[model samples]
Target: MPASSHRPSPASPLEDDNLLPQILLRLPPDPSSLPRASLACTRWRDHVANPGFRRRFRLHHRRNPPLLGFFDGCGSLDFHPTLEAPERFSLKRDEGDGVRRPLGCRHGLVLLLVPKPLQVIVWDPVTGDQHRLDVPQGLTMNECYESVINGAVLRAAAGDAEHFKVVMVAADGDGVENRRAVACVYSSETGAWGGFVTAPIPYDADAHASGLFWRFSTSIYIDHAMLAGDSLYWQLIGNFEGILQFDLERQSLSVMSVPVPIYSKGNCFKLMRAEGGGGIGFLLMSNSDYIAQLWRRKTDSDGVA
Candidate 1:
């Protein structure tokens, strides 16, 4: 026989099968890369789609967390505290455009609502992504409409241990009959604005009274929330005195009160759940400085006086 004929025959199909599992086990976890490898063949996709493979992919995404971009000056970027631990970002008028007042932020996005007529810009704090969302169309149509302003908050929720919610409130244009206040929520998981909720303004007196409670309340809001297994606990300043909790799952409201000093009319800032006894603290700005006042659970030492 010729020397070339001495080559061994190809390995049985079983040998090819044995090699596949090994290749799948080693595929790169980057979601961008995994999708491409999956296109190579049916077997590749099967392996890439494995639950174990997906878990690893998720882990990688978790590690390379996206950065939230924000603006300090009109054209400049603000970088402090990083995105992980947020520090309060301030807002001022754009001077040139009287319409865009730098409003506070909620989720990674900040709101800039034009004072009178109503124009709004939702800008991301990390990427500086800007989205111009219109005020609820229904509110604009009414001829009786008058003043308007937007309020926002930002936070990140942990597991069941804590729930974080960002509330976007609109001080409706007061009509002779009602103060048509509206509240909408932007959730991290669903990444969409929640349905518009209507609440009758408790005080019919004037615009000044609408935000009275916000002056002294201490509230915590999440800048982002996870889906699949995330939890959100939120409280709403239903009028000045009635506090309400919004359960994300049931999409319903429950009545609750933020402790006296905790929700009092003040600079309303910074909140974290307490340890052991589990209370909440409200930070207030006095004169020109800020202070932390902790409100703990009332002990049996004395019943409600």
Candidate 2:
């Protein structure tokens, strides 16, 4: 210790301003703990709130949870506590039930399907805000068939909460040989439905049953979509066995096959959005072997995963 007679030693490097952020970056990935750490001081709060810090924090964790929230695959909506994501909060529906099911979820918004007159509701589980838009008219209203078709949420732009788009690949008719599909887009900004974009179905739609019991198991939409850049990917029905990609920017549709050669019965496949590279990844899990295989897309290559 020194009292003016002698010079005090320089403060430790830990006390330096630069060292604070480096310490905060080491915070556990559990987002619930971050606010508690921020309570320590305003400086800690600033560090924790930084966007860069949040990105780095996600990458730091080895086994970061994949699901933010999920559709219960039945006719209800709830959060999975074990797989809960602190960044995106859970929602509770107040509307009296009359066949409400989760259609799609993306970018903090969830698409829900409600029948009787046929409608799709866009909901933000975090803020408890929602916008309801009627499904396009002149299309097939078979609730059993429509629920299985693919739908997706497209953000208007990153960090723009006021606008987003809800798109659906709906069935034009339920014919057997030449099944046709139509796409409808709903813009939150315009608050109206867009014109239907039509296309030819590759495979037979009648191969799968169309009943309430079959509705849960089968659909033209194989699984929830994987968003990469401006495109959204959805796995196809069993007969087709491929992925349907919709380019939000171009407003076009293209089909691609699964990486596997022969589609096995009861095999599980998932399309995932790459964490860092902004590319896409496909996860395959076959019942034959319990091993899970993950393949990432190669941007430079012409056709590789």
For every model in order, what is the number of clashing pairs?
Answer: 16, 0
TM-score of each: 0.42, 0.63
Taking all chains together, the TM-score of candidate 1 against the true structure is 0.42
TM match of model 2 to true structure: 0.63
lDDT scores in order: 0.45, 0.64
Compared with the true structure, what per-residue lDDT tens digits does model 1 show for residues 43-155? 77886778665544444444344444444433233545545445444443355445355555543456565544454565644333455444545542244122333444444
Worst 10 residues of 2 by lDDT: 210-219
lDDT of 2: 0.64
Q: What would the per-residue lDDT of candidate 2 be over residues 120-233, giving only the tens digit for each residue?
A: 778866446777777776554454345656677767876554578988875444543444556677788888877766656566344344211212222355466678888877
